[model samples]
Target: MPDSTAPLLLKGYAWLPDLRRRAHDVPAVPVRLLGKRGTALHGKEAVDFFYDEKHVRRHDAMPGPVLDTLFGRGAVHTLDGEAHRARKALFLDTLKDPARVAALARKAQEEWDRAEADWRGRDRVVLFHESARVLTRAVHDWAGVPLPADEEEATARDLVAMVDGFATVGPRHVRARLARKRQEGRLARLIGELRSAGLPPEPEHATIARAVAAHVDADGRRLDPHTAAVELLNVLRPTVAVSWFLTFSAHALHRWPEHRALLAADERHAWGFAQEVRRFYPFAPFTGGLAATDTEWGGVTIPEGSLVLLDLYGHDHDPDLWPDPYSFDPARFTREGVVIGRDDLVPQGGGDPAAGHRCPGEDITLALLAALVPRLARLPHEVPDQDLSIPLSRVPTLPRSGYVMERVRAEAPAPVG
Candidate 1:
């Protein structure tokens, strides 16, 4: 098989889907990546199959570049089995708890309010950059990480760099590596300082940084300072990364102006709008794991130790699964009493988050989007003439012009509850 590493780089999110299409829409498509045998699977069934720990393992599956740029080494994303579960408990507590999520949402709204006020005076503001800063402040303040006002913008840039540069080789990749090293060092020192000061009286009441500082793994060992720093970035980076979705939300509202009225008028519609933005936009292309054992699915066999990629982008846009999948329609999610299936609409990963490799911050992502995107729609701002075209060839692509806005009306409506 021809190595797909170059094609994947050139084609970005469309690579796997286009490959499967050319192969007559096979359920399992075999290929080579970096001289290693690999298979990519599609559909909701594939999500369940890929997440089954008996069939696949995440340990040692991620590329070194991904570890260095996106998820840090020793981060929860790299763990599996009991160790994964133990580490995941910390995220589940901090990210999944309803009250904690609500608090973060509230903080995000407050930060947006402050930033919107500041934007009014500026001639032009980039929604992507400004929103990142808003989320940076919100996550840090909510997580009890002391980010001084002056450092907030720099931190946001670093967080964005880590995600932006993870998928390519170039100056962007260099920026990502340097950002991770700088942040990991900064956060490791903070973890040490908190440990020396002693843990808070109540663990339940503790901040995320404190909780991570004190958490012990399944093997009865606390994460080392560096690993703890990685974990802290695990929390911080994803929240800031939501700026991508938020910016996409701005793009969506501009392209499809009808949704803005619905999103601004009804809170439920805003939730649906958030879901639609995640689905319609390009974010994660796929997630990979190593085959834990020889496994057969859809009449295809995957040998142990081979690469197994669950097709996230393809599955979400699968026409059979989603009628008119290419269309941007929030109403698909807004149907009365419509409950999203665990395996469906996986703009993130799929399967049960608590027991599997799914992102624990999924709830937080949705909540932050639900809380902030509506406010964005309600804010009176003009979309200036700019290059809003999103390139599909860029992994984690965004609007080329960063969705510039000008002639802003700063007197936005009150934050959504």
Candidate 2:
């Protein structure tokens, strides 16, 4: 079979689904990636199957370029078995707590309030860029990182650059590499300083930085400074990455203004709106790992060490899973008695968060979106004329124009008599 890497680069989010469609929507679509045999899977079953440690393993699964630019070498995403479980515990402890998630959400709201004031004085502001900086400050503050005001914008840009260039080559990819290097070096020094200080007592709130710094891995050893830095970024980077969903949320509100009033009025509706934005947008196209052993999925044998990719974008948009999948509808998530199944939405990934490779930061992502998107809806601004088009060929795509807004009104109108 011909290699699909070039096609994947060219086709972006459409690559896998288009391949499956041509194969008559088979449960397993065979292909080649980076000169390795690969099978792509979709649906809720695929999510469960892909996440099972006995079926697939993440060790050595991520490409080198990705590790260098996106997740960082030795990041939690590259572990498996007990090592993965142990490393994951760090994130689970710091990120998954209800109280902690709420605190982070509150921080984001605070940052949004401050940024809104700055935006009000400007003629036009790109919501995407502004949101990134806002998230940067909120996440850093919550993570216990001392981000000086002067360095905030540069730090946010580096974080955004890492996510932006992870999937591509050339200039963007170069920037991603440089960005990761700069941040990793900076964070590693911070970790070293904490270590040299003999590890001070953590605060009552238990920040992620302190938890990660003090964490001992499955091997019963604290992570080295570089690895510690990577873990730190694992928390910091994804939180900032929420900026993508935030921008997409803005795009959604612009295209469908009907949801704005309800989003502002109902918190639960805002949560549903956040879920829909995650489901509909093209953030992570797919995620992959290597088959742990000889395995059969959909009656097709996947040899040990073969590449396996779970189609995230396709799964969320699958008609069988979501009725009218292409349509932008938040009510599907807002049904009074309905609860989202763990495997139901694979935007970040699937499976038990505490036990598997599913993103532990998923809660934080949802919380930030829920907190900020409603405020975005409630804010008085107009979408300035620009290129609002989202190109599918760009991995981690956004509106070409970054969703510019003008005529800002940050405060609520006086109550009508």
Candidate 3:
């Protein structure tokens, strides 16, 4: 075990890459004990901490941006342990079976069709942030009613601005608080509209919305519209952020004509490919889990009540687990490679994590991606830089100057077949 007194580096998830640690570093996950935080932060070293009870119990110990002063405490992330688990479970119930995924895919196709038509025979279209806005509309539409374009656009803009502040990772994020306050005013106006308009019919469309409509807590009361609005806005962060993943993956296949063949060779191929794309280009490489109780893990001790960040990107790319840490390997998910999760093991809060706060939109994202990847491929087009790896700096970059390529229009339907 390393000495407990060793000077510990407190690099948030942002600095993981600079440290040169990948998925397979240290024989197992590192459970760095900062002084007295040994027993409280258990599972930091578990071969699979995703499912470890100790890990789940250390909820508040994880790091996260504080909520706005106006809202106080609302969502599961703001609450710890039992309260979080209970609330999260209720929200998760809506995604237990994600049939809405297909609808969202169809919706995505419709939006793309519209966008393409608007291209007006232009060979390329610059798209990055626009793709996310498109998905937001789909998600919102799936929940019940199509959002007014203006409202949807406003929310998407606010979400991006707020998150930009968090990514700053320090005093800068604090500076962003004022901007966040102003944005909240706009959000309040939107919520007022939703409340007066009534919730829509898309039950499984989004967990928070669905829960607000269907859930009855121990008190047997559903969420008020204001609380519902806060939760709803929170969901947008991951959903739209995922837009980057979808765009990056599309960017990869479009650039590398060979990948189009790979995508075509098998229809069932996209799921695994998508997973790898997520792992390969993890937008948010790491997240923190605070130690609620003192815990000992991986032969190291972490004192109680300490903040610990997990280097998901580092661990995913660790040399021990990945032969070439920097190389992009989509098939790493095969039975041989490390699978971060299973039904029994759940460490992370988002998708693949335990039942507690799994990303409800996992299916929504997959289905939308599945349709988009194949459709773009089946059609004909070529764009320069289609194969270029996403640059290190484009937090979520895609071909914005437009995909410079010609379309291979689909052949007219055969006379009989």
**Candidate 1 lDDT, 1-417, residue by residue in tens:** 899999999999999999999989989999799999989999888888899999999999999999999999988888899999999998898889999999999999999999888888989999999999999999999999999878988899999999999999999999999999999999999999999999977655799999999988999998999999999999999999999999999999898888877886799898888888898899999999999998888778899999999999998898887889999989899898877788888988999988998898989999999999878887888887899999989998999999999978855456798
Q: Per-residue lDDT for 187-229 in model 2, tens only?
A: 9888877777666465224567777778889999999989999
The lDDT of each candidate is: 0.91, 0.91, 0.52
Per-model C-alpha RMSD: 2.1, 1.3, 5.8
- Name the weakest run of 10 consecutive residues (lDDT summed) in model 1: 406-415
Residue 317 C-alpha lDDT in model 1: 92
Higher-ranked by TM-score: 2 or 3: 2
Instruction: Write down the TM-score of every candidate.
Output: 0.97, 0.98, 0.73
Q: After superposition, how far is residue 88 of candidate 2 from its true place, in Å?
A: 0.5
Query: What TM-score would you give candidate 1 relative to the actual structure?
Result: 0.97
Which residue runs does candidate 2 get wrong by more than 4 Å?
Answer: 200-205, 414-417
Go through the candidates in order and give the clash count of each: 0, 0, 36
